[model samples]
Target: MSFQNTASFPGAGIPEQVSFDRKELSVILSLYGRMVAAGEWRDYGISSLRECAVFSVFRRTAEHPLYRIEKRPKLRNRQGQYSVVGIDGQILKRGHDLKTVLRVLERKLIRAVD
Candidate 1:
């Protein structure tokens, strides 16, 4: 079988995978640290897809993710790129500002303390 170098051909036009930049990861990790300290979070996973990137938080490694923070650049103009989704598969928040969108999860930390 023959192989193709689509990845090597710059002009071939493939969608670039999305990922968390350093600044974005810093913000996410900051919240993760606080949540972990609060005993609300235990594990996390990250996915870099062609059209979107996701950061999933888990209460336990063996169970399903408790939350998923997604960045879909394609929706940046329509519904904003950053979003926080609950374990029930509901959108907790969506906004252009990553920090603002993450506040939804941060609020949980407060309730966990109360």
Candidate 2:
């Protein structure tokens, strides 16, 4: 079996950090912009970790993240790769499609718009 570029450290078993590609980032940022314009979201941060890629949204910089969008490639076959987790660590949505999972957050945006 070949590890290739994905699993760089063959012996360490640390596996490289997961990350969002340009296209994925574009989609995430598009929603972020709309939410920001609606004043639903104030700040955001991205974290690429060994297990998953996280995009955390904060209403205020000092407070905890209000929501987190995570991508775990390992779950792509089982529970799906995309998930929306709330501030309380509850899974709001989980699916194979990233956009579909992110729809959960759009509900807040809808409320903010009207």
- For each candidate in the order shown, give its overall lDDT on alpha carbons: 0.92, 0.90
The numbered model that scores best in TM-score is 1
Over the stretch 11-97, how does candidate 1's per-residue lDDT look in tens digits? 456666889899999999999999999999999999999889999999999999999999998898998999999899999999999
lDDT (Cα) of model 2: 0.90
- With a 3 Å backbone cut-off (N, CA, C), the pairs that clash in candidate 2 are none
Give the runs in model 2 whose Cα sits over 4 Å from its true position: 1-15, 112-114
The per-prediction CA RMSD against the true structure, in angstroms, equals 5.4, 5.0
TM-score of every prediction relative to native? 0.85, 0.84
Among these predicted structures, which one has the highest lDDT? 1
